[model samples]
Target: MQDKYATLAPALDSPANEGFAITPSDSSDLQQVTRALYVGEGGDLAVEMRDGASLTFKDVPQGSILPLRVRKVLQQTTAAYLVGLC
Candidate 1:
């Protein structure tokens, strides 16, 4: 039998806790985000996937980590702090 799903490649290096101000674009320069932990510092972060799906995080306190799979970030939104754990 064969696996139904393929495993993603391991990250070349450890994930760094970096701040990013995501903006929507038609550019395909987006990275292949396998997983990410949202670091609550600023306000809540809203995520939009490539499949036209959306997810919003509300009332997340500071230092909270929310794991999610993201294909792209929404445009013209508030700052969403996250630690990319790919």
Candidate 2:
């Protein structure tokens, strides 16, 4: 199939062309940094940003799409079934 936007530069708001399941871990980083995260379940989410800053998002709703550039999903995250969009 031909992609009309193939030549366009990808921005944060651009649709994701690739995705991978995310497992929260304290010692491991994701194979690829995410442009966004798909939350299949709701809860507090702790993550390490691409810039190496750590933070937590509280009370994230289920099925929410968070536009974040994260390198790691920390074990402190309570949310489940995370898919990293890249």
lDDT (Cα atoms) of all candidates against the true structure: 0.53, 0.96
Compose the digit string of candidate 1's lDDT tens values, residues 1-86. 76443354445353433444334443442466535655546555566654657766665576765556666655533445544445
Candidate 2 scores a C-alpha RMSD against the true structure in Å of 0.9
Off by over 4 Å in 1: 1-29, 76-79
After TM-score superposition, the amount by which residue 47's alpha carbon in candidate 1 deviates from its true location, in angstroms, is: 0.5
Give the per-residue lDDT of model 2 (tens digit) for 1-86: 99999999998888998999999999999999999999999999999999999999999999999999999999999999999999
What is the TM-score of each predicted model, taking all chains together? 0.51, 0.94
TM-score of 2: 0.94
Top candidate on TM-score is 2
Backbone N/Cα/C clashes per model = 1, 0
